[model samples]
Target: MPRGGPVPEFDTIVIGAGMSGATAARLLADAGQRVVVLEARDRVGGRMHTDRAAGFSVDLGASWIHGIRDSRLWELAQALDVPTIEFTVGSFQAGGRPIADFDGAGNRMSAAESARWVADVATADRALEEAISRSAPGDTYLDVTERALDALERREDALDPERIDEIREFFRHRVEEQCGAWIGDLDAHGLDEDAIDGDEVVFPQGYDELPQRIAAELDVRLEQVVRRIARAADGVRVETDRGVFTAAQAVVTVPLGVLKAGAIAFEPSLPAEVADPIARLGMGVFNKVFLQFPERFWEDGVYAIRALGEPGEHWHSWYDVSAISGLPTLLTFAAGPFGRHVQTLTDDEAAADAVAALRRLYGAAVPDPVARWITRWGEDPFSHGSYSHVAAGASHHDHDALAGPVDGVLHFAGEATWGEEPATVGGAYASGARAAERVLGRPVDLAAFAEGIRRSEV
Candidate 1:
C-alpha cells in the first residue's frame, strides 16, 4: 500500500548502511518502495570497513563468514559472485593441526603438550556444561567456572591446580575472543543457544565487498550521523548531523554499541520493553593488531604461533596470513579486558607490547614490523564496541525484544537484534531483511530476492 499521505521523500528510511541496513533498503527498494539509507561513516560497510592504505586490503572489522548453510550473507555472496576461501574445520586455523606453541623462554613446547592442553579444553567444557545447567540467570561463566573446575579437581583423575588454571585461562581467552567480552561478564546460560554450525570462510577480496555490493544500488547517504528520531503519527522524523529526513517508516540498524551509548535520541523514549534489552545486553571490545614484516622469520607452513605464560596470554594467539595475500604478515587479536587495556595505550605502546610478545616466542630474531594496522573499535564513535553479547542478567529474549517494532513506524534491525546469530554479518543481513519485511507488511525471503539483487549488479 502507498503511504497514507503526500508521498514522502522516501517511503522508508533505513539507518546505517551496514549489512543489516543495506539488506533492508535493498529489499524495500526491490519491492518498488523508495528507500534511503543513512550511514554515519563515509563508507557503506559500517563495521565491515576494510583498509587498503597498507597497499593491500585487510579487513579492519569483521573478517569471517562464520557459517555457510544457514547464512543469509553466504547466500548473498554466492548470488553476488563474491569470492571467499574456506578455512576448514581440520585446518590449522581452527586448532586441528598441531600448534606452534612456545613457552616464555622461546622454547617450543612439544606437540604432545599442545595436544594435552587441547584435550584439557574439552575436559573443561564438560564441566562448563554442568555449570551452565546448574547456573542461574544472573550467574556468570567466571563464577561457575570456578565451582565446576573445583569439582573437576576434586576428582581423582584431575590435573594439578596450576595446570587446570592454565587451561582455564586458555578457555577464558577463547570465550572472550568468541563473545568479545570477559568471561566474568558473560551469562553462564546465555551462550547455550549461540552456536552456529557450518564451515567458516574469509574474503580474499576483502569483507567490505559484501556490504559495498549490497549498498551499490541503494540510495545510501554516507557521513550522516543520526542524532535524533522523533515519532510522527504516520511516520518518523529522523535528524542527523547532515539533515532531517521524514519517511513513512524507518529501519534503525545501527550497531548495538551505538544504541547502548544513547548516541541517537528517540523522542518520547523507546518503550521499556526495548529500552530494557538495550541496557541489559553487553557491548564487548575485540581488537586486532596486524603486522607486516619484511620477510617471514617464523617456521614455514605453520598457521598459528602461540606464546604461553602469565602476562602473555592476552596476546597469545597469532596467525600467519602470509599465505592469504602473499605478504609476510601476521595478525593477532586482543579481546575482553585485555582488548580494553590495549586501547588505553598509545599506538607505539601497543605495537611494542605485540612485538615483545612475538619476541618471547621467536626470540630476538623477530624484526620490527614494516607496517602495522591496529584497531580500537571501542573508541570509534560510530561503533563504540566490537559486538554485543548476552550479559549475566540478559537472555536471548532480550534480543527478540530489541527487534520488536514500535508504533508500526519505527523498526529495529542489526546483528544484536538477531537472536539466532547475533554479532555476525549473516545475522545483520537477516535482521535487515526482517525489518524491511515489517516495513512492507510482507516477506521477501532470501531466495525470492537473490535474483533481484544479482540483476542490480548490472
Candidate 2:
C-alpha cells in the first residue's frame, strides 16, 4: 500500500519522447502551455540511439538525415553546430564480383552494358507503371515488380535466366531497402509516392542529439510506459506504469508498430476511422549489424557493397563505414522478412554470418571482426518494428486517417502519420509541429530553426 497523491495536471501530455513527441512538447511549452512528455524508454531519443564503440559514434537507430534540401533535421544540426557529413553510395557488388559504382544514375555498368541496362530498366519501369495502374485493389508491389521483370525478360531475349534472376533480386532488395518492407507486403499504388529531394547526410556526433537538443527545456518523464488514454468530458487522462496524469489534450507519437500492437488502450475505444487505418497500415523491420575490424582490408573508396544473395537474404547489402567514419567498421542491413529472421539469430551467429559474407567478397583470409553490434528493432518492445509502410490494400489516405485528430482531445503525430514523407526523421518532426499547431490553433514557425541548414549548405 502507498499513500495517495494528487494527479499531475498539464495543458497537454505528449507520449513517446521521440522526435515527434519532443517537437510537439517543445512547441507547446514555448507557447507557454503546461506540457509534459512521457517516454516509455529510459532515454529521450526513442528510435534514434547513438552508441559509442571502437572510437566512433555509431548510430544504432535512424542514422541518415535524409533530404538535406528541405530537411528540418539538417537545419537543426546546423543551428546546434552538430557535425554531419555527406553520405554517398560508392561501390556495389553482386555474387562476389564488383558490379558497378554508384553514379548519379542508379546503375553501374560498361558504356554498352549501361545503355542496354538503362533502356531495359526504362521499359520495365513503364510496364510496372501500366501494371500498377491496371492492378486490382489487393495487388501488391511484389506483383508489379514481378510483372515488370517478366515483361523485361520477354522483351530482351539476350537476357539469360541468371541475368533475369539477378535483376529481379536487385530490384527486390532495392524495394525492400527503400520501403522497409518486402515488396509482397507493400502497396503497389503507394510505390508511386514521391521522395523528398535532397542529398543524404549522416550525423557524426550522433542522431540522438537532435531530439536531445529539442527536449533540453521540456518536461520529459522517461521510463514511463503509457498504458491507457481515457478521454473524458473535462480532459484527457493518461495512465502510465508510473502514475496517472491529466491533460487538456494529448499527443500520441508512438511508432505505428506499437499502435498496431494495441499496447496502449484507449477508453471509449478509438473511432473506426482511426482504428481502421491502423489495421491497414503495415510496420516494417530494418535491422543493422555493425562490426568493427582491427584493420581496413576491404577495397578503399567503396561506400556500399551489395552481395548478390537471394531475394530476401539478410546479407544482401553492406555499408562501408570506414569510408565515412574513418573507423574500420562495416555495417550490414537486413530489411523486411529477412530483418526479422536475422533478429532470431544470436549475436555471435549474426556476427559470424556477416564475417563469412565479407570473406566471400574480400577473400577467405579476411580477418575476423573484433567487435560487433546488432540491432533487433522487431524485438524491441518500445519500437516493435523499424518503421511504417503502406500495405497491399492501403493507400496514402490511410496515412491521413491515422494522422487525423479525434474529438479535439487526442492528436497523433509520427513518421507513419506523415503523408508525403513517411518513415523519415523530417517527416516525424513535421508531423509533431503540425500536431502542436493543431493544439495551439495557430501555425508555428519552425523555419527559423532550419535557417542554419540552408546557410551552412551554401
Candidate 3:
C-alpha cells in the first residue's frame, strides 16, 4: 500500500478496485498469494459510489443489490454488519397515471409467462454458447456477437413459433432500453439473447457500502490512476499517474470502456481474443439523478415515474427511495441513449427537469432539490461507462471470452466480465473469487460459491 518503495510486484495483480476487482483481490489475498489491486480512480468502489455530504446519502453509481438472499454481496454486508433495508416495490406511475401497483405483484411471476420467458432465454443462451464454440479460431467479439444473434433467430420459431414476431420485438426493445442502447436508436433483424436475458437486484442502503465493507481490511491506494501495464517474463510493471508498482500477476478489473479506449496501454498490445471482447461488449451508461425534497409531494406512497411523453425524451423512470421508509430522496434511472443525452446537460438542467417532472405529477410540494447529484460513469476515465450490457446481436459469450486469462499473467475481473449476474455486485465478487482460485490451486463450484463466500466471511 506504500506510495514510494521498491516496485513490489506480486504473484497476481488485480486492476480496478470495483466489485469485481476488489472481490478478486480479497479471494487472492485470502488464498495467500501476494496480490496488488491497481485502481485508476482516487477512491475505491468503482461504480458503487455513495455521496453522503447532504443529510441523506445518494448513490452516484450503483444503488441497489438485486436478489439479496442469493447475492454474495448480501452475505458480505451481513459479515461487515452493513445495514440491510428491504427493497420495496410499489406502483409505477407513467404518463400521468399509475401503470400498476407492484407491491404485492412485484415478486409475482405468472406460471405461463415465467415458463415462456425462461424457455425463450434458455434457447437463446444455448444458441450463443454454440456460436462461441464455433467461432473462428480468433474471431473478434463483434463478429461472434453477430453470429450468436443470427443463430438465435435461425432457431427462433422452434422456441416459440406463435410469438416469433413478439419475441423478436420484445428482445429488440429490451436491448434498446436495458442493453444500454438508447431506445429506438437501433434496429436488429436478429435477436440477442445476452441483451434480453438476465435478472436484477436492488440495494436499499445503496451498493457502495458493499464494496467499502469488502475493502475494509485490504491495503488500497486511493486516488490512483493506472496508466499502463507492462508484462515481462519476470513480472508485470504497472504505471499509474500516482506512482508505479509491480506485481507477479496483475488482475485488470477496470471497466470495459477503459479497456476499449486504451486508457491503460499494455507494454504489448492485447491480442484480438483479449481486446476484441472488451471492444465488442458494451459499457452502458446508466445514470441516476437523485433529487432531495423537503416534503413528500405525492399522494401515492413510494412509486416509480415513467416518462414516455415525447418521442425522444430522457427521465424514463423515477423512484422514491423512501417508499419503504420516509426518506426525501427521489431516485430516477436513465440508461442507454437517454443517459448519454442527459450526461451532456448541466447539473442544474438535470435537477430542474426532475423537479419539473415531479411537479407535473405531484403538484408543487416538491421544490428544487436542496442537494442533487448526477452520476457520470460515461465521463469517468476509470469507469468509462456504467455497467456492461450485451448489445443487439451480441451475446454474453463475449464477456466469457474476456474472462479467459491472457498469457496467465494478466487476469481480468469485473461485473462486465461476469457470465451470470454481470451487472450485479455479487457477480463482481464471484468473478474476483474465481480469479483468485485460478491464481491459487483451489477450485470452486461456480453455482455454490456465493454460499461459500458468505460462509467464509461469516
**Highest-scoring model, lDDT:** 1
What's the residue-level lDDT of 182 in candidate 1?
Answer: 89
Clashes of each: 0, 0, 20
Clashing residue pairs in candidate 2 are none
TM-score of each: 0.95, 0.89, 0.74
For candidate 1, give the lDDT of residue 81. Answer: 84
Model 2: what TM-score? 0.89
Q: What is candidate 1's lDDT per residue for 72-96, written digit by digit as tens?
A: 7887788878888875322212257
Off by over 4 Å in 3: 1-8, 88-177, 184-205, 308-312, 323-325, 363-366, 444-458
Task: Please say which candidate is ahead in TM-score: 1 or 2.
Answer: 1
Candidate 2: give its CA RMSD in angstroms.
5.0
What lDDT score belongs to each candidate, Candidate 1 first? 0.83, 0.78, 0.62
Hey, what RMSD does candidate 1 come out at? 2.4
CA lDDT of 86 in candidate 3? 52
Q: Per-residue CA lDDT of candidate 3, range 123-180, in tens?
A: 6556645765676533443454456556665763554343343333334334544445
Ranking by TM-score: 1, 2, 3
Please identify which of the two predictions, 1 or 2, would achieve the higher lDDT against the true structure.
Answer: 1
lDDT score of residue 272 within candidate 2: 92
